[model samples]
Target: MFTSAIPSLRWLQGFEAVARLGNVTRAAEALFISQSAVSHQIAQLEAHLGQPLFRRVGRGMELTMAGEFLLDTVGKALDHIRSGLGRLDTYLDAQLLTIVCPADIAQGWLQARLHSLQAQLPNLCPVVSVDETARYVDQVDVDVVISRSPLQQAGLTERVLFDDALVAVCTPALAAALAQSPQPGGFICLEGDAMSATVGPHLRQHFAGWSRRGMFDDARLLLDAALRGLGVAVLSRAVASEALAQGRLQCWPGFAPLPNGSLWLAQAQEPRSALIEQVVAHLLSETP
Candidate 1:
């Protein structure tokens, strides 16, 4: 079962780690080994495969053409192996679904509706992960992910959860002040993030003449700023519902809701489990 002519799995593991992270030190840290060890493993792997797998570029490393080919094949193998191993343990456990979501959406929407999930899936012991970068959803091997942007990975089942809407709102006093002046940069603005990409165009379209008195990346914080009368803010309906109902803030007149597409729920298609199916169904039916 062993041969010197064949490369070792340890070498392959090291190669995969290095290729994914593009840093030998990070790969070593991920593998819980010394950087020197990772470098040695990569060297041995290259020697065995008879090809240069990586090349130094500026301050970092880039995969070679050979490296890309190996990664494309090796990466799928690794994912399959990991998924298989994960399925061997508690795969059918109703309480074992792991859900990944964006931070703002989690704080604004999912947190409020968690009780509904509990009521419908009493056996679900949900583990929630908040990843704004969204780089490691597949690597973490989550059971489900609620995403504003689709991950678009292969072998994933996509389901529409709900559509999102953004509206401009602020305290009554702030609204009155804006009505008086309506100068450029007079509103709170969100820039440089996924939420900004989704809502920024709508904001400029509605308040083309207004100026930004404040800028925020977090929608919840933006809502708070709006509540304190800092400036008018664009907020998702889910995040602004309570404040609007309580009369804490009023909507800016003449701005209608802008559709932000459906929030998608995705999971691997194969190795399907009843637990995942049931929970997804519950989320679809009970999210009102």
Candidate 2:
């Protein structure tokens, strides 16, 4: 445990100013204080420390050995204090918006739209956090949240981003091969409580005989495996949309996707600032 024996900041400021300028009048001018006030503060500090920090040399002040040591430490400490205040200012900046969502949503949906969002709001600085377990909008300090399920918290406005569906997707070559005969490759599975519950029955009924090539906790990884021709991956339609449009992966025919869940965009009903409202509006305008 540390004792509260430290001197006041005003006294330290006076001491530092006097030490640097080497004159009481100049130090008082720099601090916007009377010379008497600076002199009083220095006197109080020296009395508190039980030692004279400065030596009177003609008309100017000179630091003693102890004063030199204290100045070095005090200068660094003041710099750190200024730096911490600067960081706080950044957090309070209106243009910095933080958006939180699941890893899959960040990678598949939000990441692509971020560039356009920034283009619209040129001063906007977005901070995105990929957290799968963040279910509530108030659970973290974020301006917006993209969730698969509706957040039941109060003081939040939610909009359905899209109705998500699970689709079986694979490379064009793999889809072509499966059209003629059952492909030799296994099924890439997304392993999570909710995802397993959704995809488990589908896989058992459709491709029970196929082996398991890879099991991933992230839908992004599952999509990547399918793109690499590792195996047929059952992933969210939104996750595979870009790839399907680009013709990198083809939807397996005869396997109609099942409605899995709805993706929602949620934010505080009373936003921190009007800038947050504009950002959220921009996001909604871009949503399909």
Candidate 3:
């Protein structure tokens, strides 16, 4: 009967992580082990295999041929294990929940709120997926779906994330163009999913000439265009906050403040976990 003279599963895990990350410290951090411990485990594994598994690189490590072979197989095995473990963990933490939200919300808003969620619910991990602007997420994929409002479907639970009013932000030079230009035109731009039509009645009313404006499906792209003084772009404050602070984009006070800028956090009506509320609380809590 053939058996693994390689090493224990723990040592293999350390080896795979260290090999993939190409560094002992980072691998240790990812594997939740001490660097010295990982190093020791690798050495033990190498001794058992009767060959060196790694070679020194510039302040890092690289896998030797044997190490590479083991890593290729072990990496796939570990990934499968992780996926299985994730499922098991979710099952154990049945009260934990997750959601799919706007890309901007995940990167801009929710990102800054994760610490609070961890503080409130220690086992929480918001599985964020950047999807349609107003689309509903599969209940099986995520516990909730966070998106701009004007309910697309009637079903599912909804929590307000706060109105993400569209503020036309541009550089000082662009602002001067808007103020100096005689004609009232949305010649500037506004970015979001092309599907942002589902936002609300107020969005349609305010962005009267959205067709003429620089339309984009991605907020980051529009934010970039606006930064380059392309045109005045109506953007979510959350996504533009950093640039706005840096004086890269200045808000254009040309129109009434958007009142329907509210974003909604939607979950299945019969959710099986408390993860949604935990995620919502973190997402909605004001940032200081």
Candidate 4:
């Protein structure tokens, strides 16, 4: 299955390396080949494409417009190939299920439910990846992803996990003290831009002279600070639900909870197996 229109992968690799490193010697060193071999491959690639992919710029090579276009396309192709190769583990191990989600969601909500999830699927070997910046499942090889917002990518199905709310919570002892005194105190805040904007005005209007004690990008960290009696932490209600239920933390009185974004569970439309479907169902059933 050789396509005459397409250049050899070796030639493309050499071309990409030279374009990136800007020197044939460096590209050869990276590829574990001689400098002449790299140069020869690049020349073959240029001749096959009927264009000069690079031009000599002093000691280094600079890509031509055509080379730039090819580099972009080739880079994406290589990345996709690499991701597919990395996912061979899932194919070899049928019981493995890789789930990716935000760190806060992982620590706050999902951690408590692992035992129950395993009980539902005894053969399941769950691999949870926590990345606060992850917004899409395609960025990695994952069986399912929990996201703050619904993903609109093609070939993906999304299910609503739960609606979230931002609430101010503190230790029960702190709440009792605040109830008696009714004075402004140090506040722990989430560092999200939108959340900070909403919380800043509310704190100023309701609790005048409120000073920030700590700011955390992660809700789990913010909750930890609040539990230590550091300050009143404004975080996702779901993140603090377990602690609140256990009486380790309490919702501060007089402040209404603010509506927040919903969490959505998303997976490929064509799941790898029936077990994945069962796992998804179990998660949905467990959601309140």
Among residues 3 or more apart in sequence or in different chains, the pairs in candidate 4 whose N, CA or C atoms overlap within 3 Å are: none
Off by over 4 Å in 2: 1-6, 15-37, 54-77, 131-141, 149-154, 180-184, 193-198
lDDT scores for all predictions?
A: 0.76, 0.81, 0.69, 0.81
What residue runs in model 1 are displaced by over 4 Å at the alpha carbon?
1-93, 120-123, 132-141, 171-186, 193-205, 208-211, 241-250, 270-273, 286-288
Q: Model 4, stretches more than 4 Å misplaced?
A: 1-87, 90-92, 132-140, 193-195
For candidate 3, report its TM-score.
0.47
How many clashes (backbone N, Cα, C below 3 Å) per candidate? 7, 0, 8, 0
Predicted candidate 3 versus true structure: per-residue lDDT over 174-213, tens digit per residue? 6776578667545344444334565444456665664355
lDDT per residue, candidate 1, 17-136, as tens digits? 999998898899999999999999999999888789999987567999989998998899889988988775654554677778877777666765665677766776776778646433
Candidate ranking under lDDT, highest first, comes to 2, 4, 1, 3
**Candidate 1 lDDT for residue 226:** 82
Residue pairs whose backbone atoms clash in candidate 2:
none
TM-score of each: 0.54, 0.76, 0.47, 0.63
lDDT of 2 at 257: 84
Candidate 2 local lDDT, 1-288, one digit each (tens): 223499999999999889889999999999999999999999998888888889999999999998999899888887899899898778678888778888776777777678777887799888888865655555235778888777777889998988888888999998777667855557786886225665677777777678888888878888889999998888888888778777999887667788878888889888887888887877677665
